[model samples]
Target: MPKTLEGEIAADHAEHPTAANGAGATSVRHDRRTSVPRAAWLIGPALVAGVAYLDPGNVASNMTAGAQYGYLLVWVVVLGNVMAWLIQYLSAKLGIVTGRSLPEVLGGRIRSRWGRRAYWLQAELVAMATDLAEVIGGAVALNLLFGIPLIWGGLITGTVSIGLLVLQSRRGPRTFEFVIIGLLAIIAIGFTVGVFVAPPSPAGMLDGLVPRFADANSVLLAASILGATIMPHAIYAHSALSRDRFATRRGEQAGERGATGSGGAAPSGATGKIAWHGFGIRRGTDVAPELTPGTATAVPTDTLVRATKWDVTIAMAIAGTVNLCILLLAAVNLAGVEGTDSLEGAYAALGVALGPVIATLFAVGLLASGLASTSVGAYAGAEIMYGLLHVRVPLLLRRLVTLIPALAILALGFDPTTSLVLSQVVLSFGIPFALIPLVALTAKAGVLGRWKNHWATTAAGVAASVFLITLNGVLLWLVLTGA
Candidate 1:
């Protein structure tokens, strides 16, 4: 596929800093420079990746999980988080080793034009499905908070989220992370109140953390949890985030004379740039500097990978804790309540038990969840679109396009809860498509050199991928047969 113009610009701005001699091209140098301690590299991409786990999809899915099963499916959330950790790590590793995202690498590897086109089509569908959950979550949050109807609430969500994106463009990813992390804190506070107000039996909740579903519906819901938790788009987004944030600057001085990486040259107009920072007040250096001139630090590939792993683990662990908290609160307060499968039902039930003031806290959390996740999903979509199709659209235009499916769902009068659940299931299906490629690329000695996946690491990743695919397929079968 040809690179889009914005893709070329992003590339020029990102990859060519030292290598292009002012012309934009990817510059790779394999010499030692400066290495930072693992602790020093802890703050950027991994924190951003964790935001995917805390989105409104997770809120909705966990709400259902806790209310229906009363902590019985807490194990599923745990499982989902574990899967997310593995998948995200592998995705990020692919980016560091090859300095390209899983989707971009697929663009190079798929070979046949038709095959690549087919991949793009499916990936686009996945992105839209992703947006569906996020948009609905935000809209539902608005409805809950202000008593608006779902339709108008959705429009409001769209407007506010776009405004936030424009703000994020100006503020930079660090600001975006702070905003997301702050929203996550709101969710945690909401749950903290619920856990104290309606604490479940500790022993019982612990038992619930073991992997057993109460029935077939639990199985179907488990898939939704995986979709919301593991998150297909997150895998692609993490790889790109890590690659761009921590790429090496080794031997950059030599590149000042105009040299390119062994990946070689692109045809004219093929040098696509992604206008990721187009709306930002700061230059690319002020945002992600590893890609810009004189900004990246040199380190051994293995050390960089090691530091990244620790970073991913800590951020993802916090995310997993948040998912668990969401499930725990629902189980304590709304589990088994009649008609509590949806967010509103749960809210009403809580209002009855805890009174309106405390119940309103639920809406506050939901609004935060919705707002953060909606912005994130749009950004993830932009990342995938650029990586796969090498195209760039205005941020609002990108946000608007992703909103189409969400609007259609509302127009056709789809049940918001059911639509959210189904959207997660759709995300589950996209996992293997992303994971299989990550495993293959990471295991290639030529691609990663010494940083390639060891046999044990490759085996683990492949096993996890197979297990995820099998479980997703089983969930699909159960849903099809209405089991």
Candidate 2:
């Protein structure tokens, strides 16, 4: 077996015609240089994945934290976001270096079929919980905005998500990314504008930054916030997103080379070039070369990894800011307010204290969060199933199947905000299952070659894992003991 990722790539390349022909050596070298997009163009994947952080689950958790605890859990949101930056970067790096997602890697590694099925069960459950939160949140948003019934609103949300998934399947990843990013912009504006209108007291905000929890309930909320901020599905989705963005198709490369007449520049839609709005962001038509069935792309691993860092950083910054803004908006305006415990309650409270416009924006943002996140959650669920079981279910079928749980809850008349918060807690329980594996795999030199995590990186990953697992343990103890 090949020892490192590059060795594996080289071994895979040995079978290709270009690698076999000595005359094609120069062409291969030129293709490697031209096929790698500049760092700036590699920005969308992480941002799209980052939307998972700003989902309605996040809005509910953060809003509840600030309203109930009055900034006590602010530290949790910040810490979670900081950890998310590292976790997401590692995920993106793994995909950029290895050309496989976390699930794909794990699926191949685990020897037992039962073990893989068991793992898939947990991941599927987590994905369902995610869908539940997103759908319920969307339902609540629609009800707040237009007085639509929760059941009907849920049906609408699920239908719209199917449409979004169709957009992703039909239009290609770039167009899908552009649409998600546009929704992300709307989410940012909708959530953050309220904070500027009624800024939290600086002293209170700083005090809230201190690491302390009031009680067992506080710990639960903290866990919910962390779960919402550092999502398991986002981790799974980011790796896949990065792999899709960077993976090069050899047939496309050869076709582009032939069509360009050898010496002429590749056209706007050539293999390496990613065109947006009728213009190419990168020079070449293709992005990178394929390594193997499940391995790294031909782009220089270091360059892609570096670009992934920027991508993850920018993504985390936006997600973290929007999350903080949500908490702060509630902290300043809704703390001690009776009706602010739920999203609808919060919306009504915001209108009472601020104005109708601010409340409307909050509802709009929540709607965007729900719509965007449910779509991404569906995508992640599909990837998870494909990676673990190697089964390819139609996206629409999966979306409809997943929507049943959320719609059922809404139909049963469960509190939307409570469901959202509890769903995040379920997500928190799932964090270690995804996170520990990611950390362990990325630390392995065999998996990532020289791009494997350095000792420091591994140590940080270990620390994060320990912290999260410990928190979950504490939460379990508290809940069981009725603390």
List runs of model 2 lying over 4 Å from the truth: 1-37, 248-295
Which window of ten consecutive residues has the lowest lDDT sum in model 2?
273-282
Q: What ranges in model 1 sit over 4 Å off?
A: 1-41, 247-303
Candidate 2 lDDT over 225-255, as tens digits, reads 9999889999998988887766443333343
Give per-model TM-scores.
0.82, 0.85
Please give the lDDT score at residue 135 for candidate 2: 93
Per-residue accuracy of model 1 over 1-483 as CA lDDT, tens digit each: 113323433443454354344332223443432234333433457767777787777888888888888878888888778877777888877776665667767876778878877887877777788778877877787888887888777777888879777766766555666777787778666655776777678897789878887788888788888888888788888777665554333224123322343333432322223223322122222212113222222333444566677778987888888788778878887876888888778789889888786678877877777776777677667767766666667787777777888888877788888888888888889888888888888888766665677898889888878878988888878878888
How far off is residue 420 in model 1, in Å? 0.8
Candidate number with greatest lDDT = 2
